[model samples]
Target: MFQDLDATLKALLDDAAGPAELQAADVSFDTPDKDYKPAQATVNLFLHEVTENRTLRDEARVMERVGDGYTSRMPPLRVDCTYLTTAWSAQAGALKAAEEHHLLGLALRWLSRFPIVDDRFLRGSLKNPPQLYPLPTVVAQTQEGRSNGEFWSALGIAPRPAFSVTVTLTVEPFDQVEDLPQVESIQITSTSIPDPTLAGRVLDHALTPVPAVVVTVVETGAQTTSARDGTFIVPGLGFGVYTLSVQAPAKPVEQVTVTYAADHQTHTVVLSGP
Candidate 1:
């Protein structure tokens, strides 16, 4: 009979995590890939965040086609939904939650669904682990009770559209980093957004040692330092206030707070040190 989990034992399980949002079910990318080979055209599925008339987020696309007719005519569907987390679940497996949070972002880079749809999450049970095949996926969402006869119709699918089966993931890969070695006892988690302002050479540049710059998420005050490679990953942040700060001796500490619908939480934070 086991009651409380042993700290030593728990850390041993690399692929296991507890109290995570179970956002393990995020998406399955399929759009319009090349022809499906001998069969015909390839099939692609992409996850998209619905906007007024177009996909506002980094709507990805996976493609699978066969000739002009054959092959699997049906294309994989992209899912872009929200996971409403209270304080409880959000507290568990911080690093994992952070990974899942950023992975959910589709606001930047425009992920290529073609190479990742089949690797998405598709499962009949939410309790069990998810598959690694289907690229796009979803999380085991916790929804409040809904009213009867109240269907969740994509209000914008104008032209009087119909409804059908939307292939969802059995589990979403919200955060796989939870199983990493660096984050064992103390959970390390974060959130993300795509910072488009980081495009030009000015905003993003590499620098050497001298108080390595830290990528501080403008909102959560989360911190991740840059490596010798001048790389840092602050993944899975959400919408709200945030700042990225850089520190260098003999030079003024640089900090910038950003507020944009981040396409992806993982952005290359660069600083030109003095």
Candidate 2:
């Protein structure tokens, strides 16, 4: 990922800084020695530090559906890579300082134009596999590299003008995960059972049918009173075990468990009491 960013920056500089070719190299802050000879201009991108973007940190695990099971994986980690960018010139003369300063200005302008590097500019493995967003780029003064005095002192070199570039990237986790079971579809089976009809007659002790006797299904709370003929019928009830309750005047409550059948015929019950 760092290599990709560096290459992209180099491409941008080479395209913008015309006439003189600029090469991006991983070098220290100390100016190149007299024995070393580089192109007319060089952009040194020194990766100095890396910091985690805590705000992008997430505790929730990522889940994906694979076939009949779900695969779990850790969330991607976000980090900011800081690069110390220093422009150099091979020319040695009174105008060498001015030439290096001019090259640096051009590099800064070119970098400023791209606050974010588009995905098309990305190369290598970064172009495929894990999905990533356009990298955000920022050229600014860093607290650690406030001045050339302290910055160059840390590198054990003379002071020189330089800027900081930070590119934020999202990196996937290195761990592998196993797929787990997940419910895909639920199957419901229905039988063509006949609806039930409960019918009963209420009678007094004299064996005469008693009208107005309330017959209720205890499970469903469905009740019906006997007609003038002392007969009651409840239809369209599902086939199941139910408690049939019979109540009339001057008679104690009676309850009986009846397992309804699929015959679709009326179930008859006879009740007689005081």
Candidate 3:
């Protein structure tokens, strides 16, 4: 990693217009003493992110360290540069031969403290070394409580909240996405019985269905109503058993069948929320 960083730094230094002497060094973290291992915890970096106009004032503390530590500090980060910062994790137990096996993973963060717009450092002057973004938040998802079987168990249920995905993109303005029209339908799912008593307040997990809720009868291709409280009544039906499905945005699909009674068919299915 040092070799790669050295080569990249050299490449950028030669391309610079000015004749400024640039030096590179590595910053390390200590645990009371240098020999102790920092296992499975917040690796703090008490680093600075200085820019031309403004700077991130807050100081962050971190534990883990990666080989490619300071790529965004110099080089192509000159001015008006736009790039993505990626993070990696390493197993901290053993390097060569003997060590205890531990699930201790460490976080690696690459930040762009200075958001380059043009040939200009939006945060700092292009003349000096750039400061990477102050807070490179890594989502710490440890398998602390849940077992491996829980993940596998999700598959057994017909339509259980199985998996989640998150995608992040840096854009000039976030509202630009709201303007786009719905050529394709996006489904957000939630349970019909949102609250037993509370009227307005919704649990943090459930989403208030926007546009409308989509209820589809698989065999007949029939669609129905979307009430203010998000309920649809299916009527004029003979004695039949069918699977009813409901879904919404960024939510799990829910399916439960009901045998319509001759008098009244009132059935409710619970979607495991959040």
Question: How many residue pairs clash in each candidate at the backbone level?
Answer: 85, 0, 19
Where does candidate 2 stray beyond 4 Å?
Answer: 15-39, 65-69, 144-148, 178-274
Each model's TM-score?
Answer: 0.22, 0.55, 0.23
Candidates ranked by TM-score: 2, 3, 1
Report the lDDT tens digits of candidate 2 across residue range 1-274: 7676566665666563443433342233333333435555666777887998787677777888898789988787878888877767767886778767776776677777778876666666556654455678889657664555655666666656778888788788658886777864443323244444655566566546678888899988999988876777766677778888988766777776777766533444566544
RMSD of candidate 1 to true structure, Å: 26.3
Better of 1 and 2 by TM-score: 2
The full ranking of all candidates by lDDT, starting with the best, is: 2, 1, 3
Off by over 4 Å in 3: 1-211
lDDT of 3 by residue, 1-274 (tens): 2222223323332333422221121222221122333342212221112222112232232222334231111111111111111111134434311111111111111111112222231222222233333212223222268443543343242221111111111112112221222233343433233222101111123344333445556556665634555556654445577766666446666666666554424554444565
CA lDDT of every candidate? 0.32, 0.67, 0.31
Candidate 3 similarity to native, TM-score = 0.23
In terms of lDDT, the best-performing candidate is 2
lDDT of 3 at 204: 20
lDDT of 1 at 43: 13
Global CA lDDT computed for model 1: 0.32
Which TM-score value belongs to model 1?
A: 0.22
